[model samples]
Target: MSGIVEVAAAVMLRANGTEFLLAQRPVGKVYAGYWEFPGGKVEPGESVRQALIRELQEELGITVTECSPWLTRQFTYPHATVRLNFWRATAWTGEIGITAPLEHSAVEWQACGTAATVAPILPANDPILKALALPTTMAITMAESEGVERQLERLEQALQQGLRLIQVRDKGWPPARRLAFAEAVTRLAQAHGALVVINDDAEIARQAGADGLHLSSGQLAACTSRPDFTWVGASCHSAEEIARAGELGLDYALLGPVLPTPSHPESSGLGWPEFGRRLNSNRLPVFALGGMKNELLTAAQNHGAHGIALMRGW
Candidate 1:
């Protein structure tokens, strides 16, 4: 392959942030007829942000006002190796008119996290879509600290307040008890249109009909291939572990103690600066995991995290 081609892609969310636009490649271009996020090639001397702004203006006819770097994916096509830099375009000015008729044949906004309504999407974009579907806050179960009944009550309140991503990780319970709890959590989560991932137990996740699995760092290191789950994630403490999660094709990762927490009082934390440094230009979405709360959402996102994950105070 020659020098890698850098392309900037947008996950342009509507005002509600629940839907994003996808465009069809116009005829005569490579991958013509395939659907993809709207973007174009980065030119020499242009940063990814500069390319993104230019591409959106040229293709969608809108001026980007707010966008955040999310993920970077590198794929080798038969002809060339391409690196796709993805940004979440949260806000823009002007209506998106089809000004670049030569670039896109059609454009439509679709709900995030749902199965794609558009057919024959670009092969390199599958994980991008999955990442977009992840919620901004991942709520972990605190059943041990809060009694099971109290926890269930809290889960209901959290779900009602729009907590869409969850993890069930009460590992001290007996196998039968854990399975039962997983089943109950799944049922409640599904009812609220939330997703539940069981920690470190693919069998329990499967049997409980949970949406995914969350691998411990040990489990992640032991894995040779991606687990068969719709939304597999792993706990990553170091940059090496984060890279391993990406190699294993996990949909997302939880990285930190960005701050010192009661759970590990003696352990020093990554802090915001180090957390940002570690996650910069990472290929997959990562959630800031220790000592996180809803108020830190912006802080986490500012540091290149997809969102924040919390055991308490979500």
Candidate 2:
């Protein structure tokens, strides 16, 4: 077998970040006519970021001004094995299509949180498309500390403010109370077109009609199979845990204590550098958990987080 090919793929987004660019492979390329994210093979000795900057400029005529490591996926094709390093590009210079030579036959912007309008997307990119649809903020319920009624009121307010993803986490509560709370959260979230996942309780998740399940670290380690849900995620505090989550085919993982939190005051958090290092080249989207607030989203993204998962800040 030949050596694996390293490629840098860009998820170039519009200013609002609700859309990303996709290009139709030009004739004569392997997958010609099929659509894929705009990018190219990484040359020897070139870092993925460097390749991303060069590829976007060459293929789309835009100089990428901002980008971050997102996910890495490997695929084996008839022709070769490829390791695709995906980056999220949010800012750039030069107008697409008009500013530079068009390397592909065509290009179009795809809206996030929706099915692709373009046909025949490259097979390796199907999972990436799904990951892109996940919202950047995850609210973990704190009904254990706050009263159930108060938490429900806050959840409704948050939904009104455009919160689209939530985790119903009240492990301290009795099973009956937890189930009732999860049911109420699911109902409110559904009304706002949001998704609700029950923490560490598959029965409650199903019983409450939650959209998915969120596993605690202990539950994640004990699982032998992916749970049956539309979306499944886990809490991960280490690289090994994150890898396990990916191996289990989870939709996402929450990794951190990126900053010190009141809940874990005795332990110092993994600062941004360590968090970035642990997250490098991860296959699935990961949310930075613990001490995260609305304003920390950009900082978290810069350190390779898909988004931030909050308990109190949300």
Candidate 3:
């Protein structure tokens, strides 16, 4: 038989570093008796999104208002080959209690970072679980002016406020100014135990002793292997671009214009639904970009985004 088996899942998470829900399988099912992100097969003429909504209402008694599709993974076992699209769903109505375990044996919302230790995750879910564990934010520096001292102060301020991840995107500066700015940011990052990725200037990033490099989409596509660094990231707007980023051994990617923005006013945002669909990714970290702010974090997560890459958003 010729067939394509499709599936969907939800990573319903809370913002307080609290928890995400998982359900245990019952008897006589594929991957039976293992913990999993609750979801089911795509039914006749039903989209993955529709299947998720139906599954959530049936399994957890929670009505969803918004969902972000994030990770997509494919796995084959002795029993079956499945394509899974994962979404980050946000609850709208109905209290999320384990209403009935008729099909699902039990459900619980345990702390997120501790999932691996919980034991019994289905093998297909393991990679996505690890991807979710990584920190989801990246701060790229902006130099609207050549004032080195002023920029340093900005970097310092961001660092003080728990900005552990950063990128030195000082491209407009002439060579000497760029080097000075990178050096300053690197110093600040070190003092705060933060990691700074230099943008597109591999040589400068290396010379200034930065933590790693942030490749542009062009650079990412051209690379054959990852640069020798502690962290590597890229900027991308499409799925193919993100796949390439992963192929080059990059650690993560910032993808977007998911919302209408002045940065690219001529373009339209990805809208939450499409944004989530695009992310059904199992590759590198994909932080939603393009006109994102902190107010969208819950929405972004629900939509399948690891997090947001922002200028205004922290």
Candidate 4:
């Protein structure tokens, strides 16, 4: 078997705030009626970007202008291997309404994560979408909670065990406790070669000498400028919030409740498939959160997720 045959795909997301244009495939076709990103095969000798511009014209009658370079990934199937190259094209000419390209039947611009969303979505694309819906991991640390002294102990454990980065969240402490935990954790994570962001407290982050800050979706709208730091992340559920956070120049995000969690059994959850659909081409890097198990990491990574955030999946 020849590895992956070269092909290209376009994630033509309209910067229109709330909705992304999703197309449903027609019946009587391979992966027919499946919902998918809206570009097609690359012709021989054409560059991926060129193929994108041409495919958009053919499929949706749109002209591409500017695109962000992102590698969602390559997946193999039994029938054929697809080396899918994708880009987040922001600058475009015509609107993304379909122009009757062959093999497609219906299209709609839906909120990426609404519960009402359903699918004829292809399975390979699911992982990318799922990853897009996750938010960056923001870990909470205690100042000697449960007789744990060094706040860095857990952090160090996480990092040494392959955790690349995280935010340090601390609450219920005096100024001294807060500062001490922040300062010590900051130094500890840095010494262990990890990036540390502070949770919802920009001032404390700045004072404690952290790498950056993290905010909830509610706080995202209030941010005028990104903090002067190396990293910034946010929490989001809806596509609107995710876009808002992205527009505010957040470095990444955590978006979830993708699956029902033992922690929160009351509210409805976005099952894995629909979660992937909404998150497929999110502007900012997203880490899967809520109900993330260690076993799900491979699934999340395959779906275009940057990583996973967890409360108990250590």
Candidate number with greatest lDDT? 2
Report RMSD (Å) for each prediction in the order shown. 2.0, 1.0, 4.1, 16.2
Candidate 4 residue lDDT tens string, 132-231? 3333344545444533365466667877775646666655676666777788878877786667777778788899999878886767877888777767
Model 2, position 89, has a per-residue lDDT of: 97
Leading candidate by TM-score: 2
* lDDT tens per residue, model 1, 117-199: 99889999988888878998999997877888988988989899999999999999887889999999999999999999999
Query: Model 3 compared with the native: what TM-score?
Result: 0.75
Q: Among all windows of ten consecutive residues in candidate 1, which has the lowest summed lDDT?
A: 94-103
lDDT of 3: 0.76
Local distance difference test, each candidate: 0.89, 0.93, 0.76, 0.67
Over the stretch 1-314, how does candidate 2's per-residue lDDT look in tens digits? 69999999999888887898899999999989999999999998999999999999999899999999999999999999999999999999998878988999999999997999998999999889999889999999888888988999999999999899999988988899889999999999999999999999999999999999999999999999999999999999999999999999999999988888997888789989999999977999999988899999999999999999999978
Query: For model 4, what is the error of residue 221's alpha carbon versus the real structure, in angstroms, after optimal superposition?
Result: 1.6
Residue 37 of model 4, lDDT score: 74
The list of candidate 3 runs beyond 4 A from truth reads 92-98, 105-115, 134-136, 143-146, 159-164, 172-195, 201-212, 228-230, 246-249, 256-285, 290-292, 295-305, 311-314
